[model samples]
Target chain A: MVESLVKEYTGKLPVKLLGELKDKLTAQKINKTRAKKIFETTLQEYLDAQVAPGEAVGIIAAESIGEPGTQMTLNTFHFAGVSEMNVTTGLPRIIEVFDGRKNIATPMMDVYLKAPYNKGKDIRKLALLIKQSTLQDIIKEVNTDLMNGKIEVEILSAKLDDHGLAQAQLKKILEKGLKGVNVKIDGSLITLAPSSKESNLNDLYKLKEKLKKIHMSGLKGVTHVLPVKRDEEFVIMTAGSKLKEVLELEFVDETRTVSNDIYEIAENLGIEAARTAVMNEVFKVINAQGLTIDERHIVLVADMMCVTGGIKGITRYGIVSEKASVLARASFETPIKHLISAALTGEEDYLNSVVENVMINQPIPTGTGMPKLSTK
Target chain B: MPKVDPTKHILVPKHSKLSEAEQKKLFDKHNINFNDLPIILASDPAITHLKLVKGDVVKIDRDSPTAGKSEYFRGVQ
Candidate 1:
């Protein structure tokens, strides 16, 4: 009986809400006649809640979010408890997200692991494996011998062992990476000699600098890692984001691991992911500052920004300049430039949007003005 | 380059193409046409697996906090 009643309202009400309503009616053990009455009222209420046609939702959403935006703090640094990580928050983060800036101030990633990795078994080792380790980090001392035209270095085995890197692997990397230089390893001491006898000390000295920067192990761009305990699971919080490489790791939970860099997410995941990131990022900043704003407003902004299949900022060079009307684009910023370009192209302004109509001192085509009456 | 599995990503939702009958029904209900709706590029990574043409409409099943499960639509451009 409940199934038939829900089927009748299938197209009228949302499918999820209808299912919930059916479950609720079944749990209450309501009769057929009364259940029909309840369903009717709910359908009526939902229809009433929807926004009407010709409503100026854009302006309303702008005002709703903009009003609370003024109270946000300008501070960017937030000390993340015992982790000793500095995360960008508040107004600066909000700007970073909306600007669609390629390079963010503080790039970060929270890497969730799968199975045994999340269970805290060898989690620290996994963190070490993901962090970028350089030759400078494991070397005890580096010196140049001008007479021999070579560079000598003393390795710190303890530090090397902590990274779980083998001496043979280090030697192999040194031999492959350094050009025209032969690498020799004796106990804890290592030496790099120029392959050509005619080579001067200047060439050997430059090779010493290059040797310090050789990537030893771990993924590139992941500078620091800290395994943080949240509830019963351990998640690694990285200081820098290398989302594509990190997601490929066997231990990483690819579905849940996320990067704070919006551009990185778009480049790796998709625009929809970036859209959600923008909304979540903005809402997070707003919530942290103890400000209240409706989710609908943020959703509207995010949808508008991502509607064109790519992320565009709210700046003059972004969504605003792409408006259809020449007057609208000109009015936003750099008016003279837009006007001249439009004139050169013989552009026409339809005055369909709010800005152009208002510029012409006419009835703006929004709300009451959207619909026109024609006599028969 | 490694191919991304669009279906497995958590950020993306279930997207399906609307048939001609369903598309007409949606347009009639909203009192709008194809040009009136928002657009998504054919090259968008989110729908790379869908293999959509230029003017097709896609239906997105979004699990939202405010409205539970909500529906969003975009036209391919």
Candidate 2:
């Protein structure tokens, strides 16, 4: 009877909500008459709770987000000692998301890996594999004596095994990578004393710089990596994001690996994913700040920014610039520039938006003022 | 190795182009114009397989966190 009865309100209310109502009704001793009354009242209340026609929801959403935003701290909060990645958090993160800035302050990625790797197996090696490693990263100290025409590099051999590196392999790499200097490996120490050419201080300094710049391992754009165990799985959280490159890795779970960069997401995954990222990122910051804004507000903002299939920021050069009303665009930023351009184009402001109407001292076509009455 | 598919990504929702009848019904229900709906690029990787042209309406079945499951629509551009 409950299943049959609930079917009546199918399109009127959400399926899940109706199912819950049906479950509640079935538990109690209720007749068909009482059940119908309950269903009818539920629908009535749902309708009553809906936003009234012509309500200015955009303004409300802005105020709701902005009010709590003022209290947020600017500093990036640190996770326990394991992960020292300085991810942009708080108010700055919110601004960055809304602005859709290409060069974000701290672009990071949550790179999920496949199988045993995700379960913290050979984690340090995996981290090293992902991290952009240079000769400088492994060097503990470097001593250069211009008098002896030699530069000795002391390696941190303690964690070399963790990075899946052996002394011989390192020696070979150093030998192949450097041309001017004769590379000599003595256990954990590497001595580069030029044999063919007598090198000066300047030549030695340039060689030192070149040695530091040698690309040893890892993908491009992923500079720092830390294997972090979250819940039951370990995720390789990286300081820099190279979504395309990371996704291409055999061990990486391409389906789940994600970058916080909105532009990167848009370029690779299209605008819908970019929109979702915007919403999720904003939600994460707001949630972390102990603020409770309705998720609808965030959703609306994301939809507005991504509605045109290209992600646009809320800034003057973005969403604001594309407005049909000249007054609206002028109001956002650079008043004279927009006004003059509108004049040149012979643009007519239809006064469709609230700002245009307010400029002309007309009743805004929103809530209460929306309906017009005619008389003969 | 297989190339990554944008449509199969976790963040992307299920997308399908609606029939003309379905589009008409949706517009009638919402009292909406084609321009009023959100716009999706014809070249969007998620919908490229559909071979949709500009002006076609797309339906997205999104499992939204706040509003539960909702069906959203966009006009191809």
Candidate 3:
């Protein structure tokens, strides 16, 4: 039993400690390479301390790095290389809600195809290449130009194909970079035109050939070509770019989604701004959901949410205290694990026994089990 | 009589280990007049269980079957 438990604990030690150590190193601005070295050395020291230790240091090192309580977001992010590629209406604005910021716009191609063109397509790979080649490159180019004090050119929509006109207004946008650009790639029909910039047609054709030279498939010396379908023309086109190179840009407004109970509480209390009032709203919502929260936790949340400007997911900054970050990580797995780990370290045999006993549905002593009627 | 203190000590009937003479001797040695002490159980199960009480002077035995050894716990009764 002891061996198995130790094995289990030791197995989790490396990975868990790695994450904690990484976070600590990130906060300290220790480079990734140095951080990895420290992690290995520290882990070795921890195992060594148990057997033959001149200086027992693992616990101290662990404690220093193992901050327990931090809130983390389950939210994934979208980065369009060009800032303004709209997937849907107000999609760019919605990205801001989830903390996105790269707003520099350029020609972005959003590929949509009819029926047969959809299967066996790795659109993500294509998106990545185009985004890497265009939007990110453009920023570097522009920034370099600005630093060198050179005038910037208005590099707009690249090219559009013929069958893409099937999209009507979307096709027109692709052609001219109107409200937005659209891109459609169908078989055997490559038409390149811009409604607004017919004069830039020569430039568009040259760029199209450059784009075709990109080997999207793993065919040696074979450049990308429009596939021809019998009686159906292949089409590929261009539009306004919406790729964001960086994740979470600056000064995007964040919205706090309050529960209806909180709204009701605020509406009734009419104290929208006070910190205490905010806590009350939070607790009211929590209670409405039939969950109990400790007053200390409430106070902590209030201080973080109201006073600290911690709007849900944006505060990926600052050093989180050891206790809080651990709790935060543990909470994601199991709050009970957090409770046990907080109450007792791995060294506490009695605590481990009690926890294990409780897990197995065995009879364990509590308040009323204090040797009632005396032991025999 | 230097304005004699009126406090008194009484012995509970259950703990009768201390004889009247022993009690008086203890009182005198401690400069505690009989009136200054409170009632205490003599030889009560609690006295033995915790091995303590007011004016306790007792010898307790500590024997462990696992270690197969014996030790002594001595205290004032």
Task: Give the alpha carbon lDDT tens digit for every residue of A1-376 in model 3.
Answer: 2223324435434444544555576578765456556656776776774434223233333333222211222232222332333223122222232221223122222233334433424333322332323221221112112232222222222222211123354234333432222234233222333324333545444444443333221212111222222345222222332212111112110111111222222222211222243454444434443454454444434333322212231223221222234444343445676557667764333422223445556654443332347666
The alpha-carbon lDDT assigned to residue A44 of candidate 2 equals: 97
Span of ten consecutive residues with least summed lDDT in model 3 chain A = A245-254
| Best candidate (score: TM-score) | 1
What shift in Å separates residue A118 of candidate 1 from its native position after superposition? Answer: 0.6
Expressed as tens digits, the lDDT of each residue in A225-294 for candidate 2 is 7788888999988888888888888888888899999988988887888999999999899889999999
Order of all candidates by TM-score, from best down to worst? 1, 2, 3
Every model's DockQ: 0.50, 0.65, 0.01
Off by over 4 Å in 3: A1-166, A178-190, A193-202, A209-302, A308-376, B1-77
Q: How high is each candidate's interface RMSD, in Å?
A: 2.5, 1.5, 34.2
Cα error of candidate 3 at position B33, Å: 63
Deviation from native of the Cα of residue A100 in model 1, angstroms: 1.5
A24: Cα error in model 1, Å:
5.0
**Which docking band does candidate 2 fall into?**
medium
Q: What pairs collide in candidate 2?
A: none
Best-first order by DockQ: 2, 1, 3
TM-score of chain B of each: 0.92, 0.91, 0.29
